[model samples]
Target: MNIKQSIAIIALLAATVWFWQTQPARPAPRVSFKTIKGANITPADLKGKPVLVTFWATDCPGCIEEIPHLIELHRQYSQAGLTIIAVAMHYDPPNHVLAMAEAKQLPYAVALDPSGSLAQNFGNVQLTPTTFLLDRNGRIVMQKVGVFDLRDMRQRLQAID
Candidate 1:
């Protein structure tokens, strides 16, 4: 092959490899944060329990829309060894977060990540209602970036225990 053709082929191969390597990795990011309830939670806490860590915001319609589903998921799966954590973002103040949790009658544990600590740790959180499903070992299994369908979520829960 001519030198020019050889170089072109090598460049093409390199680009292909780069693109393949840049794809998102399976198992979501790991982030640890304190719950608004003053509970110091870490990935370690989830080591023996299947954990659903959901990132949400009060202003996001999609996030608000999923509350009932989340509550239901917790109620349904609690006996099955599932832990549902609602991590509300946008530091709306501790009292406000508590009040909202109370108003919603949120069945699962709820926390406010006002400092963005959890979100930043989770990586690339560009939308509300980002949900991470972690296995009993605290390893991320699924990362859903938008609203989750209840039926699909229920099925995923079933896969846990």
Candidate 2:
């Protein structure tokens, strides 16, 4: 094969890999949330709304750093049918979670996964600061494992009706 042909084949393979990585979104998992205020929010109640679900821990620096951004997201999008749920990992102490939520004045629901079932339900999430962005139809459009891109999130939020 010629040099140019080899390069072209490599490029085509790379493109195909990238395309497969962005598979079609899957339906939201069947998990319920118990907010710190003792309110229960089921997947049924969250339908027809753009939902941002984050698995976080009090001790995770990345998770803590994302708090302000999450709060702002809630403030800006809550009225427009956006539901942000911060699910605290079962390993985190409830007292620490409550204190963090209160200290930060988090505007969104802070759910506690006391048994880690919620995390398992959300694809056995084991990393802190993992985020799932769901469309209005309850299909997860994005699942990010680290710090999420703010601009991307804003653009996604704008499309929800």
Candidate 3:
């Protein structure tokens, strides 16, 4: 190969390697928030229980679309030591959360993070319906950005228990 071609190939390889290494590890950000039922929910509180933290906005279509699956997952897994804690990052007021939850008929425990503290803590949460699957030891195992798959979430929970 010509000198220029050889140099270009080497540069491309180096860039690819750098990009691969620089990718942020999946689900590293540990998040904690308060439950609407006047309880403190944190990583330490979830020890020995597989926890699913879902960040959702009431206005997002993806978030709204996944509500039924989320509800079913909670009903099926709650008895199995799996805890689903939903943190709402919707910009609307707290009353809006209640209204939305009531309208959606969501029975799972949910919390309002009005300041978007939980979302911000996990990183830039510009996307709606971001979820993190955490093992029994409170370590994040996987992160779903748009829509969460109940099957995948169940598999992760099985890994812990």
Candidate 4:
């Protein structure tokens, strides 16, 4: 094959690998979430329900954009045993997170990771809007680092539920 054709094939392969689902074999980490409303949550506490833990910062535009969608998802699936947690990054000030959560009227739990230990436990997540979708068994079935497809998420939730 010519050089250009070979490069195109390599690029296609790279894209396939990049977009592949990341289904971690390990069970959900023994992490704890301290919600802004003074609620304590542990992974064990969320057993038998699907959970979405999104690592985001108040200053991240993408994160801000997804707030509405996240809220919608929670409203639709919460009664069906889906638990969503929006975790503010360690760098995001608590006041800013609280204000934004209140302004948006987030129905899901809003958590703070001040020590960044929660991020560290979740594969050292450093990117804003990194989301992990866990099954009822606490196994990570999906890990998306950017904007996730709403339709795809809904389908996955249905299958898991």
Candidate 5:
């Protein structure tokens, strides 16, 4: 390669290394909530377990569409140290959230974030169906803002399991 080409390649490599070294690690947020069943739930409650925290709203079409997938994931992984919690957004009416939870018969714990405290804890989650996957050590391993791939999510959960 020419000297100029070599110099450019070296600069590119340096930039890549710098970027990787400087990027801050994202740790999972410490979150706690009260389930609709009046049971208090927290990350501490599921220590050593891989957890999926999903923020959703009753009015969100995407959120509704993802419910079945979430339910399936919970069923397949709950026995393998996977904990899934569905948190209803504050904008969604509490009654509606409760009614939908019952109608859907969600197999996992369903919580209502009435004051948005839990949402705020997770980077002020404003988008419906925002999901966070936490590792067994409670680290934020992945965050999906919209629709997420179920297969990919399953693979990650399997790794943590």
Candidate 6:
């Protein structure tokens, strides 16, 4: 090949690599855990329904602040095929999580990630209130790192419905 053609091919390859690297991350990773309610929760179980997976810690004020909204969302969309799973961080005491779950009367499934495996699967979640919204096909449509916008989340859930 000519020198000019070789350079052109190299340029194309560089562009391709850049594009690939800059692409957004894939949807939620596939993993399963048993909820505190003694039920197994997994991506497959949530198929055909929109799901909101939230990682939280009992000591996190922001996480605590979002509980009511989450409860409301659960009540509002569960019948419309929305599933909400709150996973407590590994550092959180299981008893504390259970007590909180009971005291709050949480309406949805609550799981304790004592191994943090579930959090790592969802991008090494190290912050409380980290959340992922997945569509009916199990593809993550949104990922919030901190406190999320309740109105915005509601709208997104409605869109999937």
- Give the candidate number with the greatest TM-score: 4
Worst 10 residues of 6 by lDDT: 17-26
- Per-candidate RMSD, Å: 7.9, 5.2, 6.4, 3.2, 7.4, 9.0
Cα lDDT, all candidates: 0.78, 0.90, 0.76, 0.89, 0.86, 0.88
Candidate 2 lDDT tens digits, 5-31: 999999998888456436589988978
Name the regions of candidate 5 deviating beyond 4 angstroms.
1-25
Instruction: Write candidate 6's Cα lDDT for 1-161 as tens digits.
Output: 99999999999988885564344546668888789989998667887999999999999999999999999999989999888999999999999999999999999999989889999888788888888888888888787767888999999888887
Q: Which window of ten consecutive residues has the lowest lDDT sum in model 2?
A: 14-23
Tell me how many clashing residue pairs each candidate has. Answer: 0, 0, 0, 0, 0, 0
lDDT per residue for candidate 1 within 22-61, as digits (tens), equals 4443554556667766787776666688888888877778
Q: Rank the candidates by lDDT, best first.
A: 2, 4, 6, 5, 1, 3
Off by over 4 Å in 1: 1-31
Q: Let me know the TM-score candidate 5 reaches against the reference structure.
A: 0.83
lDDT of 4 by residue, 1-161 (tens): 99999999999977874665554445778788999999999877898999999999989988988888898899899999999999999999999999998988899999999999999999898888898899999988888887778888999899997
Every model's TM-score: 0.76, 0.85, 0.76, 0.88, 0.83, 0.83
> What pairs collide in candidate 1?
none
Q: Give the Å error, residue 24, model 1.
A: 8.1
Model 5: lDDT equals 0.86
**TM-score: which is higher, 3 or 5?**
5
The TM-score of candidate 6 is: 0.83
